[model samples]
Target: MNKKILFVDDEENVLSSFKRNLRREFSITTAPGGHEGLEIIKNQGPFAVVVSDMQMPKMKGSEFLAEVKKISPDSSRILLTGYANIENAIDAVNHGSIFRFLTKPCSNEALISALHEAIRQNQLLTGEKELLEKTLKNSINVLTEILGMVNPAAFGRANRVKRYVNQIARLLKLNNIWKLDMAAMLSQIGFVTLPNHILEKVYHQEELSAKERNMLAEHPEIGAQLIKQIPRLEDVSQIIRNQNTDFSEHQKISTPLAPVQKFIVLSSQILKVVLGFDEMIFRGISKPSAMSILKRDKSKYNPKVVDLLEHVQISEKERMQKTLALAQLKSNMLTNQNIISLQGKMLVAKDTELTDPLIQRLKSYDVSVGVQQPIKIFV
Candidate 1:
């Protein structure tokens, strides 16, 4: 497919000339002024290149291209000026990071060459971004799989907490949901270093000695350290580190946090609320009673997050539920009853949120030990 290019100028004739000259060579879009060009870039963009005239009214070319750099950094920019002074060239190059600075009445051949080069640069930028994202996703999956195998109880809690985190995120209209989701999934990774009996006792709501409790308290930091080793996961690691921290403690800190850090703090608080509630359910407490207990210590959580969790939980209960064969189980269904193996071992706890990985693990268990039919799940 031909790469899309946008041309911006105050002069209607110049825009028309650009369209007439480059319409066949590329997918050409023209804007009469900088404001319209910006709007087009926002609404119909990811354009491979944006060419703007420097002398446009209302907004100058350098200023417009600077905004373009903020909104679409990978889209190569070019500044075309009829009066090309050294100052204009410097501003265009420094502020807009323009790939090319050309004089007005630029030859068609020069413009075409610049556009093609810009397209090549855009391809490189987008290609690297895609590859990095894919690699990160694959690495996360592999790590989570290892965690599940090594510590199913902690892994199950992670899955449950992730569901609540997602609901709270949606209710808050958050943009960085993947960070929240990943933080939830890997929040318990630190527990892998502890003995299996400690994890089992914790999962069963058994009391621990002071030393063991202190060791458990350090799991978040351990998890953060483990996750921080991965590239581009610094924010996620921070969220995991702070999952047990009270929101008020964060506010008491002297240094103000960045926007993303504030998000991590909020996400951490939400995870704490959900994990607390899940613990209550595991101990056989009724949902209403558990909610009341959580509400009594409202200062421990973000009020908005707790309220959203209640709302999401209520709405989720209204979904249709079914009892199906193990072979019919699907991802994203909540377990209505504990799935026990033939040997009377709990395969998955009630109220646990199902995921594809968990489902695949169950299938493997079936192949190895054979599962009974008719698993109860809430869709």
Candidate 2:
């Protein structure tokens, strides 16, 4: 579609004249005065440029343009004045969001050129906004994939912790869900520098020396710095930075916190539990003994967070609901491997043999599988 331009003038004759001259260049729309221009903008917005007369009857052009800036910020603003009032011109430029000022009786060539430039600027800003969104989404996906593949144990711990964290957020009524989820997922990215032996020890709740304890403390700051370089991951980086702060030292914070930060922080506690439980469960310990082991470490986690997990662990109904909602499955439908949810569910096509980990997960959950489209999931 041709670019839309809204031109406002007090005189009908002036409006008609401008349209007659420039109608071929753009899809032109005209209004008799400032109020009419605002009405037109509200009804059909997103004009490439809004050109208004500086001295109108009821509303002066500067005031009108300022209001237009509030309503449609992306639209380039231009002022049409017969004689420049220096103060009004300055206000138009600074406060009114003016892009260009044109004298009355401007040549068609000059007017066209200015409008074209305004249009180009608008397109550039739009393109930049879209490119940022695409880049952010791609980066998050790549990082999540790498995190899962690099350390399955860590990934599993993060997911469990996210559940506990989300429970806290819901109780507290926090709004930054996505940020919290991301921070929780990659909360351990900094640990990539550590030896696997130390990580395994941590998972088993082994005693650590002073130096080893110091090394573990460094992971949050290390991970935060690693992610801070990526613009879109800025919020997640902050979450990593804050996740390990002692609750006794928690302070009144002013910056807007996204949901993801809490998710990450809460997940850290949950990771401790899951790893401990996993060590036991993997070693063929009884389920009752594993629960007793978790009980022993009550002091290691926030009491409220631990209580929430106990509730979460017992609520199989809630788990099934959450899993079904996340999987986006029909009541009797099977999810293809490709349709895995953000919460992470494993799906296997009946034609393919299930891998060891995938098969273990399926049987553990005792999922109801029905025939569906095939999707190969490598990780």
The residue-level lDDT of candidate 2 at 121 comes to 76
Across 272-303, the per-residue lDDT of candidate 1 in tens digits comes to 88878777866778887877787778667666
Summing lDDT over every window of 10 consecutive residues in candidate 1, give the lowest-scoring window.
Answer: 308-317
Error of 2 at 23 (Å): 1.6
What is each predicted model's overall lDDT from 0 to 1? Answer: 0.82, 0.64
Candidate number of the best lDDT: 1
Looking at model 2, residue 275 earns an lDDT score of 41
Per-candidate TM-score against the hidden true structure: 0.77, 0.45
Stretches off by above 4 angstroms in model 1 are 1-71, 81-83, 87-98, 107-109, 171-173, 253-266, 273-298, 310-320, 328-334, 351-360, 367-374
